[model samples]
Target: MREFLIFSRTARTGGKINPKNLFQEGRLDIIRDFIVEAFFTANKKRSAIVHCFLYGQPNPPLHLTITSSAPVSIDRVKTATLLSDLISKKKKIRGCEMKKESIIEFLTKASKTKTIYLLDKKGKSIHETKILPNAIFCFADHLGFPRKEFKRISTISAETISLGKQTYFAYQALMLLQYFLDEKGID
Candidate 1:
């Protein structure tokens, strides 16, 4: 399955955006559509959609976002380190309490210049590709036909798998936020 990752941002003047309410009852479909349109316009690629869920307080932190791309190698190490470090700081995701401001500050610094790597199960590189700010592309269909039997085209087969798009997109958005916060500092 083709995959992609997206990073989302709250509108500049607004408070934090909560992904949990994205499709609740009203509103966010509009917001999501706008973002999708903007994404396509910016990247010029056909990408599946994913949603994000942000968490925290006094401006909830970004908890999760739907994503489509494979996880970056750097992310695995960073996430593990962050969780462990939080333990030393006496902050916890499940049991203990964490200072929202401090956690945000930490994330902002830890998430910049992260790299994206896609590899096979055997751990071979797929493309060594990295996503620049905003990139997009669409799939292309077959271009040629058989010489003698046009019916042979009907025998051609395609396989499809459902790759949870919203979840992937959300994850990507958070990762991007992670990178951005790490670089620019949160408001």
Candidate 2:
């Protein structure tokens, strides 16, 4: 996932904007020119991830999982709830917290190395959270080692195509995602 500059057009199965129609009607070409001009103007790189989303759907192929409508506290609650749901669905998690000794034992049994990424919302270290020292000591004492391979990232950028404005913001967000997940030595 090298850095990219994606030029995406929405899918057109129904009432959504169709890439074929846009290209045939010459709007996509105009957009392509605009994007190229903007990229040159900003002296930015050309790596991008062009995507098409279906309209009127709860889930898109590529989606922005974060929302601004919820308050901060509610957002955190929602995040925790979603993660809890995932763990429950997997049937692998026993309780709210997996014991650190169990986690270390599992890691020790695995033949292949695993990369555990500890990401906080806004790319802060979970260690940077309150009770950091206590939490670190607890885990260190349990595992006899630290899981510190996780990297911290700041923000994501993206652009949306709407209201006659090119979705440059969504593009930037995609770039940021690529930067975070691509070729950072996960193995």
Model 1 vs. true fold: TM: 0.22
Worst 10 residues of 2 by lDDT: 133-142
Clash count for each candidate, listed in order shown: 31, 18
Best of the candidates, TM-score = 1
For 1-187, candidate 1 gives per-residue lDDT tens digits of 1123222223111233334343431223333442343223232433332222222122433322223231211233333333233323433333223333322233233234322222112222222333343222111112111232222212221111122233234324334433443354321
TM-scores, in order shown? 0.22, 0.21
Error of 1 at 125 (Å): 39
lDDT value, residue 100 of candidate 1: 33
Model 2 misplaced regions, further than 4 Å: 1-11, 15-53, 56-168
lDDT of 2 by residue, 21-110 (tens): 344321233323322322231343332221111111222222111112211122323333332332223333222222212222332332
